[model samples]
Target: MKFEEIDLSPDIMSGLADVNYTELTELQEEVLPAILEGKDALIKAEPGSDKIASFVIPALEMIDDREEQEGASVLVLTPNPDESQQIDELVWAMGYHAQIESASVDMDSDAEEQEEALKSNVQVISGNPGPLADITKKLRYVFRDVKLVVIDAADEMVKLGLQPKLKAILRRVLNDHQTVIYTEEMNEEVKELTKLYFEDAEIIGLEDSSHMLTEPPKVDGMLSHGYIYVPNRMKITTLMAHIEETPTDNCVIFTASKRGTDRLYRTLRKQNLKATSLHGKLSDEKRAQRFANFTNGDVQYLLVADIPAAEIDLQRVTQVINYDVPSNPDEYRYRADLVGSGKASRVVSLVSKQDRSDINELESSLKQAPKELELPEKVKQKLKERKKKKKNKKKSKNKKRHNNGRNKRKKKKKKDELELPRPSFDKLSGGRKGQAKKDQKSGVIGLIKELFS
Candidate 1:
């Protein structure tokens, strides 16, 4: 269904049309109406599924009706600073005046200035619970007209030890305004939070099948899902070869750790490849800049950790490589779906014997085996050759060192004999001239010859 069909204000509809978002995504189609009706929603949808719009559009519609007086009409709370920035950008791109109050300790000066400038209108506040709680307290007097409070990624916030602070803020806001909670997983924490805040409110659960369609349009002529088992040492080589073969304009490589992400990024860059790294360690500004570069096609490869769970959107990504298999089945599903969502045609994973048990268990738990692909012969051969050559080179270096040490010891013995002092013949004058002198000279000559030789 088109976004225009929804019962929204003409201004909001025109704004969506201007951005060329003509059709509503499945999640948007399912939840927008219920949200517009002022009912509390507990949505479980992936990122890039138009979930943001489901709430943002309706919230904007709600605010547009009361445009005359504004003092923080809408508040969107996210788990991390990165997602907060991304959501704020989405809010702005919709032609709505908004601000992103970074919850991070090191908020960008420019972003802070912009947020301060636009604090009076509909703005998105993103930060850790500590800073947000502080802001909420201060805004109690400054933004007394705040109406809508949204907790995006509610499940994650609870997992990251932000629950208490979040609870405090919610208690303060629930005194007068409405609350909306959105998450990808409906865990116990999410349930508890929902119960505490939206006790008597409506709950709308968008079924998984309803939100994600079965068949997505193909990018090229191929659509495949598979995994391969390889040793740990060969993971980087395998990924490089895969990217070289696929010939895509852009690709994403998922690593399990921040160090791994940086390592892969450095390795790829040293090979003269265009790549960027994204993880929780980076500053919010750096993360935004890297994401922007990747989306704009300035960077061909993006090495990201699990931080892209909810905010990254790359429609033109042609391939996704899982450098390390995710341990959690749900995480595996989420990452796989992120890249495989019709936009990315190929999803390849590098698994090893060590990873097989976990991978098999995950597959069994999920009840679907990702199509398995045989390791390419050339890649296999190259890996074996690399191992053999490394071993041989180490052996040769050790052997040469041993031989050089033995030769040096022998030369040092010869040099010591040549530098030894000789006794004077005059000291032996008391003995019989010819016999004694001949005996002494013979002894000295023999000792010298043995030592020198």
Candidate 2:
């Protein structure tokens, strides 16, 4: 659809033309009209789908034209600082002609400055959910007139543990508001939110199949999936060996946990490998620096744990290795999709015995299992020795348990043999001489009768 066909304001049209945005993408064509109509919507959009423009343009169009408006009319919730910045810039460029005032709540910036900006009677506001939620609590009037709410990268927000904060901001804006959520697909988290808060929301681009995993993931055809079956203890060795053997222009190694990423990064650095790491613990400045280093060809290897998909650019990545297989099948597809498009890229996974269930899930999602890759000879030797040690440990434990059981049985048998009959013991304990003598006579009679028989 052409922008000229829509009944948008002349100012917005001029802004769009300035940016060379003439025709609407498929996602925009489907979502733009619904948002303009004040209907709640859940849109499924892949990366690079130009999904941001759909909501951002409509959000700009919906701002109350009056200059005396009290609070922000549009609230945009992003997953990270980068996305928030992007929204702020886009809103500025598109809302320029209309003199739309927008404020971004940045966590890394001076709090006083952001607070001061919020007090300027901004028409649009955007920020990460954490800062946004806190801002809403302090400045309750900021969202008092919210006519539209855009949850950009809804899945990423949930992945970053921002769901509660998102809920907090939504709860405060309790008035009749329009909600628009953009995600890769209709995940469980997004589905639950829509059912709970979004009334009869129109879900766009979602397949009728369950979880949208009925078909295989749409990854680059040139990319290959493979795994190296190694023992958990030898995973590090296997990864190092693979790295040494297969050189790449750029590589991304994903660990299952932050501690694992740290350990792997330290090990690689110890070996004098040109490597860096990315994780949730790093400061935003440090993270951005390291990311730039990798993307700018300054670094060859990047070890990451729990990085949002939007943060990583796959264009320069040539190889991807999973140091620890992820439990979620979606993670597998995400890693697979990280390979550069149209390049001979490949994704290798270090699969251990504990990752069997996760591998099965990936297979189900991919419609085929990852091909098995032979382990390096050195790694194989280490794995063999580790298995041998584990086997010996198991045997020792079983032997110790058997010895303990045998000793317990011996003690019980000895105690049983030493025990006396209850009636004889009772007669001997009695203080009456007559009773004792009668008991002795009965005992002697019984013995004499046994001997005669």
Candidate 3:
């Protein structure tokens, strides 16, 4: 359906037309009506489905447009800074009359300044949930008249421990207000919240059995899936070879841990690969700056820790490389969602022998297996030998350690048995103390006689 058919305001339609957005995508067609009617909704739509516009339009339509409204009428909570920034820009595009400001108190900005933004004729407050509780607790007066609250990417916020912030905001938003939750995945916590918060909310994604399982290459705008099976010893070499051979313009390489990012980033940089590291270690400012550099093509590659699902978006990211196979389907889904900008993108996962089963499970969920990309025979043989040698070395060290421990215990036992008892000087004789005094006097008289002789 066209956007105008849905009863959106002229200003909102103008903003939509400015961006050439005329018709609603399937996701919008599904949930926008309920949202616009002020009914609580739990929406599940894939990334890049342009679902934000669906809710943004409704939020704009609900603004009353009367100059008398006060405080933040709508509050939207995202999972990370990148998503917040993306949504903020989207809000500005549509919220032409909104006194929009950030409620991202836990970020780099001054808490007071962001608070000032929240209280200054604020109609919409968009930010992460990390600091929402503090703001809500300190400024309860401002949230009393809120009309709607949106928990965008709710599952991701739960993963990042931002539910406490939501709990804080919900306590003060005034009861019986509208709530809309948008997420790709729903777990027990989300369902529990659904039961606790809403009396009769409509669910969107689970209406059919066919939608339960997502097929790869179609689920999240990913065009192809390919995997290279290599041992740990040959991973770097294989990765470098693949990158050099493939003509991808920009890549986000995911490592399993912060330490892994450090090591991989250094190796890539040493090879003059124009790579930098990103993980939980970097401050918010540095992380933002580095990501901006990568997006602007100043940095060619990002060696990142297994980034949270919502925080891994870039405008022109052509490829996503899993330096190690992801541990769960959520991570695999997150990594796959990176490529939804209408341009085709590739997701390549490096699967070792141990990771084959994990890859199989992920494939099972996607209902599609990954095409195989082979490593060199020489590298495979070297990897086999190195693994065997490493295993033997560990056994030898364990044997030596056990023998040393046994010998130490045996020596301690033998020394204890060979020890003699020491005498006590306080017990002069076996009889009594007076007998020893008389014996001492006799000994002195004998010594005097010998001297006279």
Candidate 4:
């Protein structure tokens, strides 16, 4: 359904228009009405479902109608600082302001500075429960004013042991406020928490469906999903050759670790390709900058760890290369679905022998093997040639090092011989008389030699 059909305010409608948002996604269309009605809600949605806006729009609309007041009006609790910042940005982009009470921010900053930076009547807070408790004590006024509480990634929060603090926060705000919880999974713990907080709330489930408002473009249609089994050493070479031949405008390569991401970024850049790396090891500012570059078309390739699966939106990504297959079947499905969104035209995964068990489990869980394609002969040949060249280079470097080591040893021996002490005249003859006579004779001879020269 179109967004205009919803009961949002005119100002919000205008804001949506400015952002070019015309219609609602399935989840949004289903849950937004209940949220607008001020009914507590528990929404089950997966990644890439555009679920952020499902609640963000209604929350901002509600806060907009309330009179300006002290303390935050809306509180969004996210799993990590990254998601917290992302929520803040969305709130501000909708012409509202938000504050992120991330642990990274120093505790001594004045509340006014904190409020000003957030730019809204809303505040996004993320931290461990202990530190969060301390910070909350200092901002009792802020908690007192919060009228609505949101918990994003509810399942992850429970897994991270923040459920107790979350429960306490909900209890603290229960007097006259509404609660909304969103999660990708509906496990028992999540179910229990929702039951406790949203005793009489509405539950909205957005199941994976077969409906699409628009068919993806033909270029995206060309993509064939599949897997290949090879030794681990061959995966990188295979991926490099694939990209070298059919270089797409933009691609995202996912690895399991920060080290892998860095290695891939360096290897691709050494081939004279532009690439950037992202992972938890980087500062938030750097990660945001790299994400901006990738989104703005300044960077054509992004080598990242799995952290981006839930956070990044790559609208023009032409390819997704899974350098390492994920261990969890659900995670594999999530990553595959994330990359296969209309944003990316093709998804390519490189599976190795060691990953066979994981792949088999994923296939069984998903109830199907991904479609498979044989490696094109040209690409296969290119990969073989690259491997051969790399092997030869390694051998040559090893031989050169061996030869240099021998030469270095020989030079060291010669220097040691040259530095050895010569037999002394004083040791060969009677000590004092011989030394004095030699010194006088040597002085006279040296003077005569200098005059003659």
TM-score of each: 0.41, 0.46, 0.44, 0.40
Per model, how many backbone clashes are there?
3, 0, 0, 5
Q: What is the per-residue lDDT of model 3 for residues 268-386, given as tens digits with 9 covering 90 to 100?
A: 88988787778877898998988888888887888888456446556547888888888766567767767545455778888877889988888787755567777755566677778
Worst 10 residues of 1 by lDDT: 97-106
User: Residue 42 in model 1: shift from native, Å?
Assistant: 1.3
Better of 2 and 3 by TM-score: 2
lDDT for residue 452 in candidate 2, whole number 0-100 = 85
* Candidate 2 residue lDDT tens string, 197-247: 665677788754233322224655556778888865677888889887887
The best candidate in terms of lDDT: 2
Ordered by TM-score, highest first, the candidates read 2, 3, 1, 4
Question: Looking at candidate 2, what is the lDDT of residue 164?
Answer: 89
Reference-based lDDT, residue 188, model 3: 57
Q: How many backbone clashes does candidate 1 have?
A: 3
Q: Where does candidate 1 stray beyond 4 Å?
A: 96-127, 137-143, 206-453
Model 3 quality (TM-score) = 0.44
In TM-score terms, candidate 1 sits at 0.41
Candidate 3 positional error at 340, Å: 50
- Model 3 stretches astray by more than 4 angstroms: 64-67, 97-108, 140-142, 207-453
